[model samples]
Structure formats: C-alpha cells, structure tokens
Target chain A: MFSQRLSMALPYAILFAIAAWFFYLAGQFRFTPRGDNIGPDFWPRLALGAMMAICLVQGVRLVLTGRDDEPGLTEGFAAEDGAAPRSSLLLAAGVTLTLAYGALVTVLGFLIATFAFMVLFSYAGHLRAHRTIWLSSALGAGLIVILFQKVVYVSLPRGIPPFSHLTDLFLGLF
Target chain B: MDTLLQLGHGLLVCLQPFNLSMLMIGIALGMLVGVLPGLTLVMGVILVLPFTYQMDVASGIILLTAMYVAGTYGGAFTAILFGIPGEPIDVPLLWDGYKMARAGQPAEALGWTLIAAGGGGIISAIIMVALTEPLAEVALKFSSPEYFAVILFGLASVVALAQSSLANALISLCLGLVIATVGTDTTYGTSRFTFGLPILEDGIEFLVVMVGAYGVGEVLARLERGYAGAPVTQTATARTELPSWRQFAAIKWTFIRSTLLGNIIGIIPGAGATVASFVSYGVEGQVGRRKAQLGTGIPEGIVAPQSAATASVGGAMIPLFAIGIPGSGATAVILGAFMLKGIQPGPQVLLHSGELIYAIFASVFLGIFIMCVLGYFAIRPLVRILDFPEAVVSSFVMVFCFIGAFSIRSSVVDLWLMIAFGLVGYLFDRLRFPIAPLVLGVILGPLAEESFLNTMISFGNDWTVFFTRPISGTLMALTCLALVLPLLGALRHWLWPHDFEETPHSQGSP
Candidate 1:
C-alpha cells in the first residue's frame, strides 16, 4: 500500500518541481514587455502555474487517500488485459537500440544504419529466425531507400567515406 | 439545388482516375493500419503525411480523408474474430461482438458492424455537409477573443472527456502548451525557451512531437510487455452475413439515435470516435429499448457503438474544415496536412476553395461506400495482417517515425527531438498520463496563445473583453462548464460512490 502511494505521488512531485523551475525561468525572460503588451513569458507562466497548482493538489490528495481519484485512460485500458510479466531489461535494450539508431542514421547513412537497426531491433524483440531477419531487413531497407531517396526525393543522409560510397553504389544500381 | 450541384461537381473531381486511385490506396492502407495492433489510425495518417508532400493539395487531402473514413471500421474484424480491439474505439464492439462471435454468430456480428459503419457514416456525412456551411458563416463573424474561447473550449473538452485522472490530463495539456511556447515568441520576436541551441529557435514541430509520442512511444510500451497477448488462433472464418430487412427495421431507431449522437459529439472539438463509441454505448444502456439485453450478444449492442464510431469521422470534419479547429486527433493531423500545404482551413476556405471543400465532402460519401464494400469482401486478407511478427512491425514503425522526423527539415536535430519525445511519451504512458491532451496541446497551443495575445492587443489588454463579447462570453462559460462538470462529477463519485453506477463512458473510454 505504501509503495503504491509512493508511486502515485512520485510523478506529481516530480512534475511540481519541474513546473516550479520553469516558472522561475519564465520570470527571467531576456526582453522587457512593451507598453500595454503582455510579455512572451505570460502564456508560459500561466500554463506552468496551473501545472504546479494541480500537482500540489494531486500530491496532497494521493498522500491522504493512498489511491488515485480515478484511473487514467491509459491506466484503465492497460488494466483490462491483466498484468503480464514485464521485462524492464528488454525495455531498456529497446530504448538503447532506438536512441542508437537515431544517433547513427546520420553517421552510418540511412541504408546501413537502418538495416543494422532493423536486424538488431528484431533480434531484441526476440525474433530468432536469422534468415527471415536478414532478408526482411535488407529488402525493407532497400525498398525504403528507393522510395524515399529516389522516388520521393527526401535527400537522406549518405554518411562518411565507406558507408556513403556504398549507399551511392547501391543507388547507382537503382 | 445549389448544394446538390456543388456536391455533384465534387463527386466529379473525386471520380477522376488519379484522385480515385489515391482514395483506393488510402482506404487499403487505412484498413491495414487499423487492423494492426501497433499501428493507430492517427499515426497511420501521420506516416502518410510525408508522402503527401509531393502530391497536389486536393489529392493529399483526399488520401488522408479516405484513410480517416476507412480506419474507423477496419478494427471491427479483429475485435470480433480475435477478441482484441485494434483501436480503442473498438473496445465496445468486443463486449457484444466477441460474445456474439463466441456464441457462433461471428459473421452476423460482422454484418452488423458493416451496416452500422456504412449507414452511420453516410447519414453523418449528409449532416456534415448541411451543417458546415452555416457553421462557417457563423465562424466568419468570430474575432480573436472568440477564436481563443473556441480553442479554450476545445482544450477543456479534451480534459473533461479524458478517461483518467483530470489532474494528470490537465498537467499533460499544460506541458504541451509549455512545449509549444518553446523557441522565439511569435509576437515580440523574443527568444523564450531556446536556451542556446540554434535548432530550438525555429521551434519544435508539432509533427515531431506527434510521431514520437504516438509512433515510437507506443512501440516502446508494447516492447516492455514483450508484446504480450498476440492472438494465437483464428477461431472464426472472416465473412459478413447481412441482417434481413426485418432485423434492420427493428433496430432502425438505434441506428438513427447512435449516428446522430456520434455526429454531435464529433462536431465538438477534441471529442473523437472513441468518446463517441463509449458515450453512445453508455446512452444505449440507459435509454435503449433493449437496454437490459445489451452485452448479451444483441445486435443493438453492436450497432450503438459501431455506428457512433463511424459517424464521428464525418462529424469531426466539420469543425476542421469550417472553423479551422480540429474536432478530433485524426482531423488535427488533417489540419496539419493542410497547414503543411500552405492552406489554412476556416471560413475563408469555403469562399476561396469551395471546390476543394465540396470534394472532401463528396470523398467522405464515396469513401464510406467504398469502405463498406471493402469491409464486406476483404475481411480475410485484412485479418491476415495480424499474423505478421510484432518485432518486424515495430521496427518498421520506428523507421517510418525516424524518416518522418528527419524529412521535416532534413535535420538530424529533429530526429533527436523525436527520440526524446518518444521517451517522454513512453514515460507518460507508464504514468497513465493521456497523450492526446499533450498532442492536442502542441497542435492547438500556438493558436491559443496567439489568439489570446491578439485579443489582448485589440482590447487594450482588457482581459474581461473575452467575457464581454457575446459569443466569446457564451463559449467561455461553456468552456468553464466543460472543465467544471467533470470535476463535480468526480467529486460526487468520490463522496458517494454507490449513487453513480459505473457508466461505460467512465471506464477505459478514451
């Protein structure tokens, strides 16, 4: 029960702190307000102030009641399926893979980075079929390259040196 | 006669081979997106936005709108056959649909869904055509204060209709507004939240926030559960067995009431198909002639939510096209599509681009007919989409998300921003904070702020001017009521829990 209360209160508490910090920043805007005009800080400050107040009220209510007033939309639906065994490690790996894919797309170019990400992500997702994984990743990456780069004209990043040269070579065939 | 003639011309435009082809592709893709568990209708629309960049505005709008129309019905197959709702709007279907399917009437259940979607969609399309012009005429009279009030009402309706904690919804909305306030202030040319990043000055694109939250964020959430609850066996064969004329005549009122109710809810900004379905089902429970028989494999139970859900598409388009405010999330994406194409949809759109407006209306009509036909004949293949591996599907979703983000400005920074927001979205989901308010906040925040500022400037900073103006005052009152009534209901439920029976709308409705 105590842990549940803590979980409920934690998000509100964190939001309150963040809202308070942003509120302070809102006051330190670099420009002064012109005559009769509301400053740029006004709208943001108003939003932040409301957020802080709601967080405080929610935090206090959670502490007193030890239960949320109601389940949120996501919470309600998520409960409908019942609790399944969750893998925090899998989630962490997924997040890492996604972030790495984002960071590497510009570095390794779209084709190589995307293909690698797809294979790794599918493996991380527990797809054990090696042939299926490799084949799908290659075909998927190639099709997307042609569609976005050649047909749609997105000008995807080609990366540096070897990767760029490889992408160019592949595109030359297309 | 004039409206009919205009509609005829619009039909002509839609019947053109290119436009017709786009519509067919859009409908097919929309059904696929809706059938998949990981791909949402709105995200599907968002993924298609980049592709629309190269097309003419008319074809672009047609494609997106067709997707919007078909997406509402595509999920019913999964809901009935597998007892898995492809979208939140399909949850109501599961109560009777899955039950009926289990009771050895799967094809009958599907047939009910088809009639409800087709009938409700067409009726609401007619209403949307009739109502949009007068509504636009009224909207043309609105000023900055009124616009701000309307937007406030939209934001408030979203929070009120949120199926969870109101406080969390409000906080999510506020956070979205704050995100919108990032970068240089549009009015004063002063930098607000850019910190020192050059990319921040141009402002965070709402599209990036949307793709990250809805697309990447959903994938992460599913990944955390190891993609649990994959439907293992296809128990029922995919086919629709249409109800007899006598059966339809018996539930004609259910059809009318649900379609009308859905259309009305759809016109209210921020309330979409999910809300319509839940609320209509709830209402049917209270007032339907066979209310006691609901959830017992009854046709009325299936029709109420399905009809309302489909009707909402037409209902949602009215505000998006007529008032420049999106009535639902999908319409918000459609609004974004318009803005991306250098078109601002509002009253003036009717005057200057009347043909385009009519074409959209005609497309909705034709799209509904085509969607129902597809739903009838193509159930087997659409359901087969569920057989694909979750990992492969999720990986492609991530790639589409990345490409979407990167293509926006061809900048790596936007990709990082999208990834960051994806994390935020996953966090929001785990914490039970609804993502709709956040996305809507980002989409509608600038309009809210700009209108508020413009109103202040026009009225010499007299904040009361918002209340003093007649229409703005009335809308402000409605906004307050929209915000307050939910809190009051919650309070009553808390203070006296037994008095308030658990309505369908109050449980997992969003």
Candidate 2:
C-alpha cells in the first residue's frame, strides 16, 4: 500500500527541498531580454515560485490527511530485503559491476569493458550456464560493436594508449 | 488513390532491406521486453534509442516506432498468462485475461484478444494517416498561450484525475512539479538542485526517476513477497489455438467499438493507454452480456481489454503527430526520438512532411500487420525465454540502464544518476508512493512551468492573466471544477446516504 498518503509525502518533502534549492539557484542566471519587456528572470522565478506553492499546498494536504495514529513504523525495507536477499545481492552485484564498467569503459575501451561487464554482470546475477553467459555476452558486445561502430558511428575510445593501436587495427580489419 | 501511391513510398522507406530487418529485430526484441516482468516499454524504447543514432531519420524512426507499436501490444502476453501485468496500463488487461485462462478457455480468450488488438491497431493507423496532416495544420496556429493551455489540460488530467483521494494525487503531482523545478532554471543559469554536484545542474533525469520508481520499485515490490513463495501458475496449454470463426463472429461489434474508443481516448494528452484500456473494459462489461460473468476466464474479458490496450497506440498518436504532445509514456520516448532529429513533432510534421507522415502511417500499419503474423507464430519461441534463467536478463537490463543513461551524453554522471534514481525508486516503492505521476510531473513540469511562466510574463506577472484569457480562463475553471468536483462527490458520499444510483458515476480505479 505505497499508494497511501504518508509514503507519498516523503517524496514531496524531497521536492520541497529541491524547490527551495532551485529558487536559490535561479538567483544566479542572466535571463534573455525578449522583444517584449518580459525580463529573463521572469519565467524561471515564476516556475520556482509556482513549484514552491505547489509544494506548500501538497505538504499541507499530506499533514492534514496523515493517519491520526501513526502505525508502529515497521522496518518494511528490512522485511523486503530479508525476503529476497539473494536477488537483492545479485542486483547489488549487478549495480557494482555496471558502475565499475562505466569507470573502466573509456580507459579499457567500449569493447573490452563491455564484454567484461556483460560476462561478469550476467554471471554475478546467476546466469551461469556456459551457453547463457557466452551467448548473452556475445549479444551485449555485438550490440556495442555493431550498433556503435557501424550504425551510430560513436567514437568509443580504444583501450588505454598502448593497446589502442591494436584496437584500431582490429576495428579497421572489420 | 493518391493515398495508395504514398503508401508505396513509405513502404520503400520502411521496407528497405536494413530497415525491414531492423523492424523485425525491433518487434522481436520489443515483444521480449514488453512481456518480461520488471522491464518496461519505456526501457525497451530507451535501449533502442542508442541504436538509432546514425541512421537516416526515417529508418531511425521506423525502428523505434516498430518497437512502440509492438511493445504496446507485447505487454498483453504476460498479462494473459501470468496475472502480473508488465505495465501499469496492462493492469486492467489482467482482470479478465488471467481469469479467462483459469476458466480453461485460454486459447479462445487469447485468440479474441489478438483479433481485438490487431483490429484496434489497424483502425488507429487509418485514423492517424488520414488526420495527422489536418491536425498538424491546426497545431501550427498554436501560440504560447495555446501551448500553455494544452499543457494545463494535460497536467490537470494526470495530477487531478490520476487516482482517488484528489488530495493524494495532487500531492504526488506537486512532487513531480518540484522535481521538474530542479536543475538549472533555463531562463537563468542558476543551479537549483545541483547540490554542488555538476550532475545537479541538469536536475534529476526523468529516466533515472522512471527506472528508479518503476524498475527498481518493482524489484522491491517483488522482493516483498520473497522468491521462496510459489510462482504464479501459467494458464497456457500446449494445445491452445486460435478462436473458432463462430466465436470470433460473435464479438465483431465489440472489436469495432473498442478500436474507435481506444483511438478517441488515446488522443487526450496524459489520459493515456491505461485509462483507455480500463474504460473500454468497463463499458463493455456494463453493456456486453458477459459484463458480470466475463472475468471468469472468458473470451470477451480477454478480447475487450487486449484490443483496448493495443488501440491506445493509435489513439495516443493523434496528439503526437498533431500537436507534438505524447498521450502516454511509450510515445513520450518516441517523442524524444522526434526531438533528436531536430523535427518539431507538432502541426508542421504533417504539413511540410506529408509523405513522411503517410509513410509512417504505412510503416506503422505494416508493422502492426507483421506483429499479428508474428504474435500468431512467435509466442511459442518467445515463451521459451523463461527457461534461459532470469538473473542473466535482469543483469543485462542493469547494464543497459546505465548505458542508455550514459549514451545520452557519454557522461558518467548519468550512470550514477540512474543508480541513485534506482535507489530512490526502490525506496519509493517500499514506501508506497505512486511513481507515474512523479514522472508525469517531470515530463510535464517543463511544459507547465514554461507555459505558466510565459502566461504570467505576458501579463507582467498579473495573476489574473491565467484566468483572464478566454480559452485559458475556461480551462482554469475546468481545472477548478475537476479538482473540486471529485472532492465534492467524496464529501457528499460522506455527508449524505444515497443508493448506488444516487451516487455520482465514477471513472473507476486507474
């Protein structure tokens, strides 16, 4: 029942902070001088103000409607985590592997990093069957190689400097 | 007919060897993502976006459009077999479809669904082809005021009409508005939510928010029950086949009615497919003989929702091609594709680019035709994906999410942003917050903010400008009416006793 009021209110709390921050930031820009007398600051400040108003209204609505007696704040996140620790662990591993891949891709090159990422991430997630791992990794690498190299023409970095010469030569052979 | 001649040109563009192959690849892949639990059509299209980068705009568009049309229909598969809906819009489809499956008529139920879905798709295409040009011509006349009014209408329907307890929905709507307010206020270079982080300068990525709220949120929802519990049983049998001609003949009117209904509703900005699917089901249920009994695993229950869901595509495209507003989420990604090509999708899209519009018409219709052919034969092979193991696929999704975010700008910030959003989404789900409205906020935020800002600017910050413009004023009244009427009805129900007949009519749970 995430659809209930208080749960919705927490995110709004995040929004209120974001709006105040935006208003603070809006103070920094030089807005355009349109043909009309409307200054550049006009629109951004208005949006910020409206956002603030919407936030205030929503916060009041949540407070007015919150359950009169708070339920014992059950450790809901813990319950969900306890139920699916294995899947959650796999998800975390997947997240970690993806971040590592992102950090490594430019350094190692898209092909090497993506290939390693797909294989590792897939295996870490429980796709350990040999055919499954090889096939999916091949699919991932093929997507990068074909889609980027041929179709989109994105100039993905070759691996680190010394190895790049070989990578360029490899790409050229294709 | 000149229209017939134009179809061949579109076919030439769409049916090019590479494009045709891409279309096939897209449909197949689209179906996989569409049906799989956890992944979404938005993600399906987002993953397809990077592939579109270097192609001619036409081919690029068809590849994505093929996915849009197919993925919209593809969601029905899981809805039918497993009670778990792939997308929230498909939630309504599950009511009758899964019920029909358990009733031992899964074959006929699925068959009727296919016919209705295909029929709705075809009709929507016909409508799009015929009307996009005329609609765009009208859209060309729109000014900032009109755009503002339109966004206002869209925002109202989503935030105000989203759920029961108007107060709750509006609160969610406000949250979206706030997130949208983050990042650099475009008018000024001021950083709002950047939090001293460079990524904050861009504010929150809608993709991050979407994946967080839906993708990660869904994972948390699934995790809640524990994987140790029994998996929902599949109602499919190896012997299931197409419906008999007699059975199909009986629901001819239902098919036609749903197609028209879907197209009409799909045009309303922010009203979206989920609303259309549920509305069609309710109408058919009330009017169709099986209304009371339909969800008991029958053909009508399956056909009505399936067709209605598919029909939303055609319906949604009305605004997309006409005024450049996407009626639903999947099309919003398609709208992103349009923006990428430097093409403004509103009225001029149909006028200056009539052939392209016609070709897209022929292309989408042909794509749907191919979907029917494939859905008929391809499902068996598709179903086999289950045996492949889930971890591998979700992991690939995990990586793809990062790549998709990064490819937008080749920035690492987006990758981390996606992860952060995923965490936010996971927490949101655990906390019981609705995610779509937040997205609707993010997507609509800029539009609404810009429009309201411009309206105020034009009137020199006069609050009355919003209420003073005739078109704007009426809509404002309507917005007030929309917000107030529901609360009034809710209050009346609380204040006075009434028979079911005396109570106000409800649009039903979204």
Candidate 3:
C-alpha cells in the first residue's frame, strides 16, 4: 500500500522538479522593449506557470488520497509474481539494444547494423530456429535498404572505411 | 449539381488502376494492424506515412483515408474471436462480441460488425461529402483570433475527455507546448532552449516524438509485462453470414441512433472512435429496447459499438478538411501528411483543390465497401496473423521505429531523441499518464502559438480580442466550460468521495 502511494507521489515530484527548472529557465528568457510586445518567452512562461499549478494540484491530491489515482497504471507496472525480474532484464536489454543500434548505424552503416540488430534481437526473443532467423533478418534488412535508401532516395549514413565498402556493395545491387 | 459532377470526376480518379491498388493495399494493412493487439490504428497510419513520401498527394491521401476507414472496422476480428480488444475503439465489442463468439455464433457476430460498419460508414461518408464545403465556407471568414480560439477549444476538448486525471493531462499538454517552443522563436527569430546544440535550433520533429512514443514506447512497456498474453486460437472460418432482413429490421432503430451519436462525437475534437464506441454502448443500454440483454451476446450490443466506431471515421474528417484541425490522433497524422504534401487543409484548400477533396470523399466510399468485403472473405487469414508471438512483432516494430526516426532529416540526433522520448513514453505509460493529449499538443501547439501571437500583434497586443470578436468570444466561452466542467467534477469527488462508483481510473478509454 505504502509503495503504491509512493509510486503515485514519485511522478508528481518529478513534475514539480521539472516545473521548478522551467521556472529558472524562464528567468533567462529575455524580452524586447519594442511596441508593447509580449515577446517570445511569453508562451513558454505561461505554459510553465500553468504546468506548475497543475503539478501542485496533483501533488496535493496524491498526498490527501494516499492511493494511486489510476489502477491500470499500477496494475501494468507493479509486476506480477515471478514476472518482475525477467521482464526487468528484458526491458534493460531492449533499451540497450535500441541505443546500441542507433550509435552503431553511424559507424557500421544502416544495412549491416540493422541486420546484426535483427539477428541478435530475434535470438534474444528466443526464436531458436536458426534458418528462419537468418532468412527473416536478411530479407527484412534487404527490403528496408532497397525501399528506403534506393527507391525513396533517403540519404542513409555510409560508415567509415570497411563498413562503407559493404554499404556501397549493397547499394550497387539495386 | 456541381458537387455531383465533381464527385463523379473524383470517382473516375479513384478508379485508376494505381489508386485502386494502393487503396486495396492500404485496407489490407489496416486490417492486419487492427486484428493484432498492441498495434493501434494511429501507429499503423504513422508507420505507413514514411512509405508515402514517394507517392503523389492524391494517392497518398487516398492510401491514408483507406487505412483510416478500414482500421475502425478491422478491430472487431480479435474483439470477437478472442476476448482481447485489438484497439481501444473495440472495447465495446468485448461486451457481447466475445460472448456471442463463445456461444457458437462467431459467424453471426462477425456479420453484425460488417453490416454496422459498412452501413454506418457509407452514411457518414455521404454526410461528410454534403457537410464539409458549407462548414469550410463558414470557416473562410475566420481570422487569427477565431483560429486561436478554435485551437483552444480543440485542446480543451482533449483534456476534458482525457482518461487520465485532468491535472496530469494538462501537464502533459503543457510539456508538449514547451517542447514545441524549443527551437528559434517563430515571432522574434531568437533561440530559446537549444543549449548550444545546432540541431536543436531546427526544433524537435513531431513525427520523431510520435513514432517513438506510440511504437517504441509501446514495445518497451509490453516487454516490461514479459509480453505475456494468451495465444489466440482461430476457430472462425472465411465466410460471414449476415442476419435476415427481418431480423435486421428489428434493430434498425439501434443502428440509426448509434450512428448519429458516433458522428456527433467524432465531430468533437479529441473524443475519437474509442469514446464514440463507449458512449454509444452506454446510451444503447440505457435506451434500447433490449437493454436487459445487452451483455448476453445479443445483436444490439455488437451493432451499437461497431456502427458508432465506423461512423466516427467520417465525422473525424470534417474538422480536418473544414477548419484545418484534426479531430483525433489518427487525423492529426493525416494533418501532418497534408502539411508534408504542401497542401494546407483549410477553407482555401476547398477553393483551390476541390477536386482533390472530392477524390478523398470518393476513396472513403470505396474504402468502406472494400473493407467490408475483405473483412468477410479474409477472416481466416487475419485470425492466423495473431499466431505470431508479441516478441517478434515488437522487434519488427522497433526496426520500423529506427527507420522512421532516421528517415526524418536522416539525422542521428533525431534517432537519439526518439530513443529518449521512447523512455519518457514508457515512464508515462507506467504512471498512467495520457499520451494522446501530448501528441495533440505537439501537432497543434505551433498553430496555436502562431495564431495567438498573430492575433495579439494584429490587435496591437490586445489579448481581449480573443474574447471581443463574436465567434472567438463564443468559442472562448466553450473553452472555459470545457476546462471548468472537469474541475467541478473533481471538486465534487473530493467533497463527497463515496458518491461516485469506485471504478478503476483506466488508461486509454474515455
């Protein structure tokens, strides 16, 4: 019960912190002294102030109710028995994979990085059929490359040195 | 008579081999997404958008309109066969659809959905064709103040109908507006929050945020739950058998009532098909002749929700074409498509591109017919689509997310921002914050700011122009009412906590 209440309070606290930071940022927003104008900072300031008030109301309600307002949220994230640890690991891996793919594309180019990511992701997802995994990844990556880079003419990244050669070879076929 | 001639011309355009093929592909994709749980109609539309960059404006709009029309009808597949609703808009289907399917009437249940969606969608499309022009003619007179006021009304409606707490919704909206203000100020040309990064000067892309939040963020959240759900067993065959004319005549009133109710709700910005379906279900229960038998696998329960859900598609297009405002998240993406195609969808578009607008209307009718036909004969294959595990589906979605993010400006920075927002979206989902308002805010924020700023400048910084102009004044009043009604409800809840039924504060339903 206490943990649920804390979980509810945590969001409000984070919102409050953001509100405070925006308030500080609002101080740096300079206004021009021409023609009685409200200036560029006006909308941001008003939005921030409104956000601060909303956060305060939410904080007060969380304090008074001592209950999470949305049960679906709690139910969705509170984790079922024995499901927490495994899911948590999966979530971490997913985030890491996503970030790694993003960074790798700049160095390894789009096709190679995407193919590698798909294979690893399929394996991690427990698709133990090796032939299926390899075929699907290759087909998916090849289609994406041909469609986006060649047909649509989107200027996808070509990596340095060795990866650049591979990217050129792939694009040459299309 | 001129409208008729123009519509005939539009029909000719729609029948072109290329456009017809695109429409079919769009409907098939829409049904695929709608039958699968966790793949929303909005996400389906967004993923398809990057593919449309190479197509002409008319074909692109047709493809999108086809998807939007078919998407609302496709969710009944999973909602009937399995207990799980494929989309939030299909929740009302679960009341009697799953029950009827389990009672060995799956074919009949599927037929009711087909009839309701088909009949209601066609009627709504006719109404859309008749109504959009007169509305745009009226909107032609609107100035900056009226535009600002209407945008405020749209934002207010979203917050008021939001499933999350009013405060949380407002906070999410304000955050979106702030993010929108990150780049150089449109009015003064001064950078606000770039923090020395050159890329920030161009501002964050709404598409990047949207693809991240709905696609990648959804996948992450599903992973957090260990991607656990019952594997669906497909029992339904290919054929759909509708009720007899006499049996359909018995529920004629329910069909008419729900269709009208849905059209009205769809015209209201922010309350999309999900809310329409839910409201129609509630109203049907309260007023229908078979109220007592609503949850007992009856035809009335299936008819009301499905008709209302489908009718809402036509209703949503009204605001988009008439006044340059999106009625729902899916339409917001359509609005983005319009902007990308360099066609501002407002009164001027009606004047300049009437043929294109008529073509979209024609596509809607074609899409409705094709969707009904496909839903009838393609049930078995669509049901088989659910056999793929959530893990594989989410992984593919992640790849799409990566491509979508990178395709916008081909910037690695955009990809990073997409990942960051994905994490933020996951947090918001876990905490039960509504993401819809955030999306609306991002899409509509700049327009609101530009309008408000322009109005102020035109009126010599007089803020009261928003309340002084006749149309603007009435809209401002409505905006206030929209904001205040929720606060009053909250106050009442606070004062007498036990007065209301203690239902779960569910996310993603009205």
Question: Global lDDT of each model?
Answer: 0.89, 0.66, 0.83
Query: With candidate 2 superimposed using the best TM-score fit, by how many Å does residue A18's alpha carbon deviate from the native?
Result: 3.3
Off by over 4 Å in 3: A1-7, A29-32, A68-86, A126-129, B235-238, B501-510
TM-score of 3: 0.95
The parts of candidate 1 lying over 4 Å away from their true place are: A1-6, A72-76, B234-236, B497-510
lDDT of 1 at B334: 94
Docking class of 3: acceptable
TM-score, per-candidate, Cα-based: 0.96, 0.82, 0.95
Report the C-alpha lDDT of model 2 over B386-459, residue by residue, as the tens digit: 54455566556655565566666666676666666666666655454445567777776777777666766767
Q: Which has the better lDDT: candidate 2, or candidate 3? A: 3
Task: Output the worst ten-in-a-row residue range by lDDT, candidate 3 chain B.
Answer: B501-510
Measured by DockQ, the strongest candidate is 1
TM-scores, chain B, all models: 0.96, 0.86, 0.97
Ten contiguous residues minimizing lDDT sum, candidate 3 chain A: A73-82
Residue B223 CA error for candidate 3 (Å)? 1.4
The ten-residue window of minimal lDDT in model 2 chain B covers B501-510
